[model samples]
Target: MMHDIPDSGDQPHLPTTYASVAVIGAGSWGTAVAATFALAGVDTRLWGRDKDVCDGINRDGMNARYLPDVPLPKGLRAFDDMAAALSGVDAVAIVVPSRSIRAVARQVAQHAPAGADIAVLAKGIETETGLLMTQVAEEELEGHVVGCISGPTFASETALGYPTAATVAFPFSYADRLKPEASPAARMAISLSTETFRAYVSDDVVGVEIGGAVKNVIAIACGMMTGAGFAENTRAALITRGVDEMKALAEALGGRRETVTGLSGMGDLTLTCSSTTSRNMSLGLQLGQRIPRAECFDGRPVVVEGEMNARSVTDLARRLGVAMPICEAVRAILHDEADLGQTFAALWARPIEAEPNAMDLSFAHPASDKAIQKLAERIA
Candidate 1:
């Protein structure tokens, strides 16, 4: 069951008033978040490492290189100088690729405004540190309040204002302390609006972070099945088993098991696996079709996060002695160490076990079973 966070007696539809916000990347996701804040009338500045991309957003009000068709709003500003972009901002969103999160966090430490709330939207585990995005923030930005926003969000869709749901996770204590600043407008801007797109806030930062990181790899696995023309049974099995793998990793990392079963875990895996827009899923589809990985991504601008995450996740799982067969199979395929048939065989050959054992079974009890039964009936 999801943990309930009592509304801190703040209006649910108000947007927080901030003097200025800085977005520290100009990739598609970064662009969308920056656009949203800019549309909300926040004095938002976006920093891109590429000079040409920055110039394009500043001059044409569009990021032709990253997001070609979506025109940025008039109020948004773009800059190539990271320090200048971060100066005096009330909040900073780090949207760099997972591989570069540490490096970017270091840069933010050097110049970001003191006491700014650092928000991490990037998803994936750091290979070297075996840390999630929020953990990286804690290590790099010691005093700042850190938060994460993640779910099955598609950047292109979100940029166009297509409704989507995601979880905003921060410490409950920190969120409680920020109650005075939480205006109704802030709540409206971030809250769940429709079934199509929503944002649920949670205090389980560890669970949310793990779900976001691990789902990319699982999505790739599902995409491979789709490309291979697998039947519905296969898809069902893969998704079910994938959740188990994700939960194991989450538990190993000190996250609540229930959080994995929530939006970031099961919800994210299901959405990414089924969606054609997911980069990792697309990459897996290509792999399933016998296309060369190098050729498939030959001219692509955005990196497939799953391809990068698979190795890091696999290494961490092994070090923790956690059974993450799905991620292991993905890593093998990426490294050309296992053929498609062998990978699938490995999955099929695993000894059958009860579903609850796939998760941290300690959370399971008689009452929990009753709750799950009721939830299942409701969905039915």
Candidate 2:
């Protein structure tokens, strides 16, 4: 929680060969990336909220609370002092929860070097402003370049040195700063990638950010289906349609359509929806078992980013005039006290249209559209 920067003499020495990187937030994802940076030979320091997690990481080389039994890279260090963590780093990775991103960005703005590149690992739209993580960073870290890294990464798997791939989208507005001679983005890409973790670079920040945010909500819906004993057909339908919902929102927000089908979108959606280790999906499982939302989170400290973003993302889609039925259904369930039956009922009542860019129903028999409309009306 160190807010202010000290005198210039207090600056930490950064290695020239390996970029100096500070990963804010010692949660699962943050710790995993810190370990990856260390493995990549970067000077990495993980900033944690509590002292015990930091103490354990520093003393035992294990994030006992987040990634127990997994030995971290020897070079990775943890600190409770935020200023000490951020000082003189070439890149800062904001891996804190979505809600905390803005505040952490402000803190980073104060302490991190002005030329340092930032990579946000937290996924989700801000509930208050309905802004994506990158947008939120822009607000608090004005004059600083912000980017995002997202994909099908489960923190535990990555911490265990399992093979993983992610996409990093640096802002194009920083083109001058990203020149081959002064390429912080290239350095960031190099620092993030390891033998086991591959990082791909992209320029479509909106597409990458939206894909990661929306998939979590879809995963929650998928988890509910699994818990309710729904067949694989239901799961498949959700996953397929969920990508469309994601693409719709991303396209509406000035992002490339193809980006949604890439690593940050389809890849992430598939991994999250199918895994019980996902915190968002696990929350959905509890709800699917008929547990009340309040009861499910009674004393748990885990931040379910999907639950936090469900309504906000739905609102964003609404403002953008994009239809996202899957996200809408998730919002209803999480914020409206809606049951599974009600969610399905609402989904069934929606107008049936041909999948986006599929066979043109207008050229096909008019009867086909009429029949689909009739079925939708009947369901309604």
Best by lDDT: 2
| lDDT scores of the candidates, listed in order | 0.78, 0.81
Residue-level lDDT tens digits of model 2 in 303-351: 7989888988999999988878888888887888766755755564555
Model 1: ten consecutive residues of lowest lDDT: 183-192
Candidate 2, overall lDDT?
0.81
Over the stretch 303-367, how does candidate 1's per-residue lDDT look in tens digits?
A: 88898899988988999999888888888888756776556655555554565673534333435
RMSD of each: 7.8, 7.7
Best-performing candidate as measured by TM-score: 2
Q: Give the lDDT of residue 174 in candidate 2.
A: 47
